[model samples]
Target: MPATPVADPFDALDPVARRATPRVRIAVGAAVVLFIAAVAIAALVSSAATGGGAQGTIVAGGGAPATDLGVAAASDGGASGSPRVATPPLLVHVLGAVTRPGLVELAAGARVVDAVAAAGGFTAEADPAGVNLARPVVDGEQLMVLAVGQAPPPATGGAGASSGATADGTVHLNTADVAALDTLPRIGPALAQRIIDWREANGPFTSIDQLLEVAGIGDTVFSGLADKVAP
Candidate 1:
């Protein structure tokens, strides 16, 4: 029997082709890296051209506009750089059963009720008479309304003060007049006259303590009048 000859391993392969496996793998890897780099570059270019953010910056719920990073005008800072404007002033007066009744400055066009509201509103003893809560207030005007069953405010002199006082030895300075000022235990017509004369010399009193400045009125007299008067 004759034996068959085996083919040589080296003889079956081309010499040049044997070296191509490493080069082929390296070329494929490079192609993949280049494809990834090309996609990244395209994305960057698209974002720059559209001026939107990389992830997209379209605002929801009616907000500000999103500008592209590419536009010069959008990035340059908008039309006006100044802040908001301020409003004007208003002035009104309140007089009646309130904590404080006097000229009050407020924003212009403020209502009469607003002035009353500022003066701490009507007091518990305030007279609802002649008072219209819904009425609009005008500047530099006066509002006078007392509470129900409440006497009208004392006149701005000694008589009003004595009338406003009670058996408890207290006076309602808001309503006191010249005659009322004489009603004080120690006050007589002469001293009362002095108080009225002093009040005429000065404008509306700012503090009851200022009463001491009147002739025949000293610390003793003023101390008695202190709790009995209001500015």
Candidate 2:
């Protein structure tokens, strides 16, 4: 018997099935599109993650906390503050009618009374009336307190009120008592006292020229006494 050709039954029912395996081809095309879309979405997600990580690393490395800097600065400020230096003490020679007479350490601007107090106060023979207790004592000064009716030494600075004339008739500016200072023809008792006060308050006279610096001594008085005095 001769073989006859068979008709495809799916082509009659579905027009879209015109090509061989048309349904299968359509399904494969849709799957390929979906895979490409998924790949693209994954690429975008990876790029986003990489960019975010790099940005975080940069921020962490570059930005230091402000609080840490402030703390460091405050600590440095405390260490750099100024330091305090102690004041140097004064050295005075306390002498005469004080209970203990010797070198006494005192604060600056110490007065005679303070010096006396440091020297164990006055002795029974300390003629407080003879000394100017309120006067400010200087360094290396000899402070002497006389007994009642006791005469002051020739060159002594503290508590000496009388002027003494030298045997040679020349008065020493640093050593002469008030009496010797008054021996000048133009100088009197008041002027003599002024000279002693000046000598005591100021340091010893370095030169006879310093006589003019005395309160009562003018150029004329100094010139007259100049020839009669020595340093």
Candidate 3:
């Protein structure tokens, strides 16, 4: 046969080249498939990284509710919850007419009665009624009890300054005799006598409020008596 006329080099295919053409096409197709797969994988990895970062941002802080700035919860009370510090026990100065008239160590919120109990309770001469047993005690405060017929030290303006009546004409609640007490408003001879009787039975009057404890004295009578006396 005459030599074949060839326009391109590839067109002049011998038996060996013709046999290799299918393999070359397959290699090129494989290279293209690998390139597309790598691009898709790269996009997926980038998307995953961005999504993870967004999730982390939300977890850090967003859409959180307001609070009392944790003030109410910071302590069972202020300076109370801090483990490094502790509140000291109350040092109540329980003096006069208690069995042990001195400072008594007590817990917070202790009452006068508790202090009296801690100080070995009231002496036989101690006016338990005069001590305001129901009143809460204070730290570093002076609580003085009285015996029968005793008067507390004078208050400002000479109130309760005398055994009978002060210059301001206020009757001393504890030391006033029946005649002096009778001078008060609504106090007749019988009521005046009763005032003295109550002081003898109870301890000395620590507060004029004690007038209500007398058998014949009521709120109406005590109201009339309130401004006329001091203790």
**Top-lDDT structure, candidate number:** 3
lDDT of 2 at 114: 90
Best by TM-score: 2
lDDT string, candidate 2, 102-200, tens digits:
988888788878988999999998778765666666565556666666655453333332233455566777765444565576875457667778887
> Which of the two, 1 or 2, has more lDDT?
2
Candidate 1 on 82-174: residue-level lDDT in tens?
Answer: 544566566654666798988777776676567778888778887544354544444444555455665444344443323445555465443
In TM-score terms, candidate 3 sits at 0.34
Off by over 4 Å in 3: 1-85, 155-231
Question: Tell me, what's the RMSD of every candidate?
Answer: 15.4, 15.4, 11.5
lDDT of 1: 0.61
Provide the overall lDDT of each model, using Cα atoms, as 2-decimal numbers. 0.61, 0.68, 0.69
Candidate 1 lDDT trough over 10 residues, lowest sum:
153-162
Question: On TM-score, who's better, 2 or 3?
Answer: 2
lDDT of 1 at 196: 52
Q: Which regions in candidate 2 have their CA more than 4 angstroms from the true location?
A: 1-84, 156-213, 216-231
Q: After superposition on all CA atoms, how large is the RMSD of candidate 2?
A: 15.4
